[model samples]
Target chain A: MPATQEINIQKLGLIAGGGNLPAYLLSICKDKGIEPFIVGFDGQTDSELMDGHCHQWAEFGAVGKIISFFKSNDVTDLVMIGGVKRPPLTQIKPDLKAVKILSRLGLRALGDNDLLSVLKEELEGEGFTLHGIQDFCDRLLVQEGALGRFQPEADDWIDIELGLKVSQEIGSLDIGQSVIVQNGMIVGVEAVEGTDALIDRCSALQQNGRGGILIKTRKPQQDKALDMPTIGVQTIVNAHKAGLAGIVLHANNVIVADIKTVAKYADKYKLFVIGAPIDKKSKSVTERTPKA
Target chain B: MPATQEINIQKLGLIAGGGNLPAYLLSICKDKGIEPFIVGFDGQTDSELMDGHCHQWAEFGAVGKIISFFKSNDVTDLVMIGGVKRPPLTQIKPDLKAVKILSRLGLRALGDNDLLSVLKEELEGEGFTLHGIQDFCDRLLVQEGALGRFQPEADDWIDIELGLKVSQEIGSLDIGQSVIVQNGMIVGVEAVEGTDALIDRCSALQQNGRGGILIKTRKPQQDKALDMPTIGVQTIVNAHKAGLAGIVLHANNVIVADIKTVAKYADKYKLFVIGAPIDKKSKSVTERTPKA
Candidate 1:
């Protein structure tokens, strides 16, 4: 009998940040018979994620060391997941490689998208393939249909459309990614405070306990591979606590973590979770497009 | 010598809301040798402002009653001033005349300016002249200069410009009247929430106690006689509490409730108060255009 054919697994480099996402991704990689190597930022990645895993700590801006470490592990494919507290320039002790990337980007590096795009390009130039998290965990993307029992009322759809228009306009300005719309009026636009604070502020401004919908989408000029708008169980919980009607997200443009758990909490709270396909031409959300 | 011709005093109508502005306007009318008649809205006009004055209370949407009250007092010139809590649609019990007005201006009846414009037309149709609050109280307009010890640094000016562009864009959409910008990033955009709430939201989002500027401007399509952006001592106090650097206003556009008190508070808090002349062509605030 012929000997069993030797099997080879593709090695992936995981740039981990804070939260359970990295660990979840690692488990998925193992289940899929893929080799995983992790490099966690000093103050960002969760320690639990590093347990019994091939992981090492590096300062956020130590680009050269990160690349070399990944190379030594034969990692040519990379995915960056989870959140990082954007540190001030003073806190970022960049190595020479990072400084070169920053200087070359110049004023265009003012926004998060621009900076991340530059990093993506740098990694590609060094012969690394940068993949979006969805590449490994496509199931985590929100499905097209309503997640829970509750569906949006007609008036809620009106508010959702209004939110889509205004949030898109603001996103076009590169100002923010989310907006709170209630009764066809904009309640708040997210800026530096981010989604959680935006939700809190909108909740406080509710009139007669009337809740609104939180709509988040990708910035018009954003690179799809980096910094897509992300939501998870915490987002659903926050919206529920804030008395929000539901959440509307652009299909193929937003990421959801632990989607089953998110759907469970949403169902418990009777919150609607929908993945809307936004029509750029009509500037409105079209029919739902189910994820492939 | 022939007997001196009989002096005639113009009868001016004061449509007052909740605040010290109506009383201040009344006093200015007295000093200017004009007879004033006050028409206050129920739950909106302060008792102190109506005390010892020829005034009557009417529901906010009681256009017929308001017109009749002014006509009985022989008031030809009218000025609307101060704040009115925007009542919900259910709360607005519009009289017959107001219903007619609202119907005529279908979609335009949505915002403050459109309603005020319709009111102005109705009053003008009956031979009443609508006068701006500034006409009677021009001294309340903020002069184009730094009002306190702490002047805006050059970097603050960059933020101020970015804010002006953004605020104007949002204003054109009739979304809000104020925006808070810090470190060249938009901190918050005021919508249903008023200026104070916007400031508080910005303050809470500050990293390392870094403060920003609060910019208030006139809506591009807003009627000057209706609802001009007005700031007062409380605005300065709130900005100070929020750890904001200063306040920026449009010259000859924003109303200061009590210029002296606002200036005093600004000085005490070491905050700068400057009135900028926005150049529509250049989309930037030009040099100081001091109030006359």
Candidate 2:
């Protein structure tokens, strides 16, 4: 449904990935007045998003086609959302462009962060501006303070302190960015399995006991646009299952889906929620400005 | 099959609890020298070690008897090895003396390090010198180098950097003592489940096309005799299973079990066994003497 007005939308780009995030963004944009162009990834970056948003789409291999589409359509302000979910290197058969990216990254002595940064640099050098998910929605960003009635105790603060230090250090290494710390000892840290498993195992470690704290953050310099750390309803559910005492968001920098429902869920579970104050000693994966 | 010259082995005191560690320690001590006095933890400490190490052992509630046993006997040096696995708060039927000691540790603390440190202090206050596992075996103190023919690669050095930084920060929280980094990204960090599980998971992550490297160290001010970092044949085996490229241990400070076999296994798997050179950055957890 292209907008049929003097301002009829015909020029936009949607760098899509395997998530509802891009689809939602593109749908909203199309509904308003713009037709979204698409740049998709293989094995990731949802295919259905192509139906919703692509004036021209790539099979992750067709980078040249994606660039040509955007250039021909006079699309500017490229918004890359979601991610290609780190492909299975052994099975990947990249197209020439992706092959170039991969071989360059592999050969340039680049680690994960180095590769990511250089990729961002290379893309920008090709006239694409980097835009984070925050550019779309304001409510997605977590706010300050306990979102619900459950208040944190001093002990929770201690665990938060301990969890933050551990999480940040791990995050800086490009590992998963989350840790379950109970009474200043980490019960679990996320490996490749992700956060839910970490929380699940922590419950077992706690022996169904109460008082565990879950801290989730982002990896350092992990291109906020590429991988904005997110927590959602499943997080609250996991916290309840894990007997976690509270949830601490990195003030305003992190993303949480649906605040009201999450707050209600926390209340239902009697889980304490605190918007951790960011100061010199404390920093989340995204270091939000210190709360006034 | 007791020692030929048994000197007052009648008053055995086994600080028994949890896993094969204390059990093995007890068996060797009893088989070689005198019997031991026992101390059992209901939930965390394994009680079965008592059967092998102690002449007579009771359940967890026998704190009074344990104190009395130490008092009655001329036992001086106390060994605190193997972790409690879990602190059995539900089984706390403390004697007056034990109750007094418990009162000193207020709430807001459940970390293993804090608990162990407090226990050590209380025992020392009562004129008991807390000893480590090293008191039993001189050879267990591993030397700084590859135990096998395999040497670490340049990439392994990068992983070591990431691993050391992350592990030290985790240690600073007194949360965990190990982190697995591969290709300058963390694959796992040891929380409650010890290093073996960490090794296996990181390896699996790599087998799924993610690389794996492991780092293990101790918290600063940690009583080395208690849970001094150890690696054994099982560690090498796990590393091999996980497809780990290398392991970076703190030089000279770590323990590698069965050096000859460990080296052979490492060589078989083409694994790199390295003792990471100590630098100022690695002292995040505790103080270290710069060696020649």
Candidate 3:
């Protein structure tokens, strides 16, 4: 057998969301002979990502500590992986420095997007380069064409097109990803409750019929490094229960955590899975603009 | 004392959403000496509405029967009241006639709007006139002006303007009525979750010291009689908990379920309550263009 190619790998900073992506990314980094330092938010960062891959760590509400850890360890670049629950307020205990920064942000600035933006700016100001997770984890990026059994009928494509466009606009608002569309109409959109609950809501709307399509994608003006969109086999399972016809994600921008498993499940459900690249010209205005 | 002009009320119908609106409308209907008939949804109609005010009624699963209930009771006109939860599927024991209607609607026809739109068409097809909840209870309509001690500042008005326009656009989609905004940014939106849950989610988003605002209004194309927006004292209480600045509802289209009690709570929280009449000129697309 031919020897595996050896490549130069640089150290990486990992801001993990609660999922297997971080662990998988770390394993890839290790195989590439790269070191990864981890920082996680409470209730969001998967603990499994810390399985002998990280060099430094810190918790949520300890933004300053995270910065300090990254600095002390000399980690200058990072990747934010997967998705997370909206921060739980019950367990948060902000340190002094974190409190001062937080206090200056007016009530409106305290929203999740604004808060995350603030953190991003602070880290950037400190001389660390934050690259989109997809920048390094090329293996996790989505590919084009149908990976599942169902390639979608003509009608399903119409709804899929509509759902994909609407979800991206919703993302631009920083509301959430994952919208349920059926017969060219959006039935439900995921907000604070996330995708699972949104699917449940969509299922309730359908009496017993199945024609809806589930769409997930990147935000229009998305900051990818801080929020890498993701999907899994479970998403396929949820789509099946909701009577969904197809599933769509942004090619390259979206992460498929366990592509093999997800692909198999999609095959079993006859659900189409496609990684659609953003058309540069159409990025400004989505194709399926909702009727006014 | 000027003799109070008693409403020479006839052909009046009371539309109510859950909570206290139905009972309140019923009492008002009784005082006026009108035998108020109701067209209420099952699982949503207060048991009280069925027992006291309605001379004719039928559950949602039986729209075919409802048309006859109104006509047989000599109810020449009708109104819709009280919001219904999405009907639970497990309880869908549709009568044969309802099954016929259900067959007419495809998978895309989900939620109350789709079903109600079809019902309205079918009812008109049968010569029954549908009406809004505020038709008889004119006193429940919000007056144009600030209704409490607190008044909106410049920034609050800016947000109000932004929200008002966005809410209308969202309304056109038939997506929802309430939107949570902060510092000219939308934080959370009401999509099937209703008002209270919208506020709860917006509150959870408070991370940088930014509280938010909640805006509720009627959809531009919404048939006035079937659904006029509403809020009450409890709305103010929820606003206070959610760390909101004010509440904005359409001056004419919305009902403050209890004005005096709601005003009292607004005073306590120093929450501004603005009731702007739907812009009279904004009926067409040109006028509907959102103000800069």
Candidate 4:
């Protein structure tokens, strides 16, 4: 993973999509005195985030125009951030460049991660170096410890372990990155429904007594340059609303949009938010104890 | 898989839980002129299913009494049928026999399948041969071919293939039995919430244009004698209500609780219900075309 100091901030390009992540990244760029060239997608990117920032708006399939916009602005270091609802292929009217890229991807179906990786390769081929959100702001990366005042108990650890195992298994298949486990039983696994909806759906299904815990991790085959599992203050609020006891995320492999606010929300809801150092092979926490 | 002819119907025992499966099995037993000794769970089993039947009701944790009830009735073959909401472990008051059985299960956590397999072994050790519902009535098993007028189009088949692949992957991990796929993206996967809830949750998340298809299969590590994926008229109705185009189930491996009614509902709702002969290793349908 490239640290902030190693990356060139000059002529940075932000491929913004929906959600607070784009806005959060914009704030970080502003703080560093780097006004990034922003590319916003129609209906997907929040327009408010691009206000007063050098940016271009285009349809999701306008690959040719999107690339030219970044190239003309001398933007080489690019970061794609935020959520984009995958539209049906029929609805996307791809330009010549996008069509060529799609053709190179072949007729076979592509999972979400696969599509992102292919897009990353295509962008890199166009002479831009793709970077993960962590490249600009490493502080957004979750560290190994409990973020809030609360800590997971012994039984919660067991559920967290099971959740990590299941999350990795699903992630390896390019399925999803989050799973809800309660009392050793997986209550729900997120697919295209996203994390918030997954939390909402699992609330009614949780077994009686102790609440479930949400576990989020990066896919084993995931290209960090393309995407990484992310959470924010909204995630904490949703987890708390779902009656979940806490949330466990893979340390250094997930992006926390607003760390301070997230921690404050977690504490307010009496929920433990911990980042665990995960062993990729074993899908287990490398260290059992949380740092004080 | 044992056929209906091979299994002896004499002194059959039906361990009934909740859902239409219990009552359906009971009706089958009556039709076969065999008055099965039925053991119903107090809260889990519907009392209506036990009316006018030779049955005894007990709490879910009354392992000793449940065994003696079957043993004293001279029930050599037992069939555990229907759905049971898994209660928190702390709520269960294990009897002496259950305590011994639980001890034998060891201290490690067990998934639903593992727990069922362990219980099957314990019962077999107690001189009762456990059989799946298929043993009593193989007609309930879904056969290869479309069950209704509608047939899946090319796009739907592609989605079905994707669904099967994901379903098998999840199943191999003992995670889920069903998956919903639309436009090459998996919308949802069933976990502890079961298939119905999975469909309902995916309904809102489905992409625009065509609706998704539901694919169900037996878990790769699943014990057929212990349990198999079972769907009924309610499943068809739910799929229809969820805006699903069709349902593809693994033939022979999945049980159709009431096939005729399910087919009727499928046809009435303009939904396709097909059973494909699945190659478990490849997780692909062996026969592609629907039988006329």
Best by DockQ: 4
Tens digits of per-residue lDDT for model 2 on A1-292? 1222222344557777665567767766766676677777766776777774445545644555666777787786567666454544455456776677767667443354565566567667779776665666656667667878887774456667767767777677566678887755678888666777778767777644456888876665667766676677788999998788877776656777667888899999999765664453545233433232
Which window of ten consecutive residues has the lowest lDDT sum in model 2 chain A?
A1-10
Comparing 1 with 3 on TM-score, the higher-scoring candidate is 1
TM-score of 3: 0.70
The DockQ-based CAPRI class assigned to model 1 is acceptable
lDDT of each: 0.79, 0.66, 0.69, 0.84
Please give the TM-score that candidate 2 achieves against the real structure: 0.81
lDDT of 4 by residue, A80-100 (tens): 888777677878888999899
Off by over 4 Å in 4: A1-6, A287-292, B1-6, B287-292
Compared with the true structure, what per-residue lDDT tens digits does model 3 show for residues A32-73? 778888877755676666766654445667877888888888
Q: Tens digits of per-residue lDDT for model 2 on B246-286?
A: 67787655766666777888888888776764556555323
Q: B155-177, model 4: which lDDT tens digit per residue?
A: 67777777888898899877889
- Which candidate would rank higher by DockQ, 2 or 3? 2
Runs in model 1 lying further than 4 Å from the true structure: A1-9, A286-292, B1-9, B105-108, B111-127, B285-292
For each candidate, report its DockQ versus the true two-chain complex. Answer: 0.39, 0.45, 0.15, 0.79
lDDT score of residue A77 within candidate 3: 83
Docking class of 4: medium
Recovered native contacts in candidate 4, as a fraction? 0.84
Give candidate 1's total backbone clashes: 0
